[model samples]
Target: MLEVKNLAVNYRGVTAVEDVSFRSLPGQIVGVIGPNGAGKSTMVKAILGLVPSTSGVVKFRDRALKQQLNSVAYVPQRSQIDWDYPITVWNVVLMARTVHTGWFREPSRSSQEIVKDALVRVGMLELRSRQIGELSGGQQQRVFLARALAQQAELLFFDEPFVGVDKKTEAIIFEVFEELKSQGKILLVITHDLGTALTKCDQLLLLNKQIIADGSMKEVMTADNIQRAYGDSIFIFNREVV
Candidate 1:
């Protein structure tokens, strides 16, 4: 389980995320949804210790996540990655085990097998030697998913995974989400997609800098909640938010 208490973030004296708190349990996928400038990305960054947090704590198993960074897996928005990095799919997935394999020591056969399984699970095994830059948008996304799976972390974070991907990629991602949940892994995803995909999450965290609502799909996605988080610009009637 993951517990975030009074989490807040400030950048250059300006508050991006303020008084945000939530708890995510295993066997569930939590969606973070909000309008632009809602601090969705900032909040994820803070919890991962990629950015500074002015207040609060992020804990897993009642221990701060900062103390167990290796147990976490993060796949940031695609734009954050340089596709031109000239690295192969196999190398990227293998890097996930570097901490466990040791920087100077060679990877054990078991670790190699784990990575191969991850790639095969994502249907990218045949292209394991291809450079990420050479793959299509959907293929690139699958590569990252394979890398995260290789990590075998208890808690996973994915930011805008469906962006710029084909329908097949989107389906695979959600399928992987269910697979992870069944294994008792926690998943927190940040997505702006307001279509039916929004209904796939076990829970939704609506934000406008502060948490607007956090509950089951039916609870958090009410007409009032959508209007409150996105304003009148986005109307929600008859449960059709988009």
Candidate 2:
């Protein structure tokens, strides 16, 4: 399980996230949704220790999350990646094995096989030799997904995974998410998509800097909750949000 308590983050004396707390169990997909500048990404970064938190505690399986970094997989936003980097898709996914294989040592046969399998799962095996910068947006996203899979982590974080991807890639990612859920992996995804994909999550964390709502889709998508978080945005709820 994952637990976050009173997490907060500040950037250059400005508060980015405040009093964020949530718990997630295995075999569940939690969607973090909010409007722009809501600090959804910042909250995730704070939880992962990628950014310093002003105050908070992050625990996984009763221990501090930093102590179990090897069991965590993080796929940052595509914008954060340098697509111009001259690296092949295969090498990108294979990098995940470095945590276990050691940076200076060669990857073992099993590690190689794991990387291959991950690529195959994401349907990026054939593009393994291609440069990451040469692939389409969807294909590049799949490569990152493959890398995350190769890690075999218990907990995974994805930031705006469906952004700039084709429908096929979206389907592939959803399939992989279901597979990971079946394997008892915990997934926390930050997504702006609020259509069919939004309904797929077992829980939703609706935020506007701080958490406005955190519960099942039905609970978090209430009319008042949506209005509070999105603030008069043009959205038509399929169900009675009331």
Clashes within 3 Å, all models in order: 0, 0
Q: Tell me how candidate 2 scores on lDDT.
A: 0.93
lDDT of 2 at 233: 71
Cα-based lDDT for every prediction: 0.90, 0.93
TM-score per candidate: 0.95, 0.97
Question: Which pairs clash in model 2?
Answer: none
For model 1 the TM-score comes to 0.95
Please report, as a residue range, the 10-residue window in candidate 2 with the lowest summed lDDT. Answer: 233-242
Residue-wise C-alpha lDDT for candidate 1, range 98-212, written one tens digit per residue: 9688777798899899999999988999999999999998898898999899999999999989888888889899899899989999999999987756778888999999999
lDDT of 2 by residue, 37-107 (tens): 99998999999999999999999999999999999999998889999999999999999999999898999
Q: What is the lDDT of residue 20 in candidate 2?
A: 95
Report each candidate's C-alpha RMSD, comma-separated, in the order given: 1.5, 1.2
Count of clashes in candidate 2: 0
The best candidate in terms of TM-score:
2
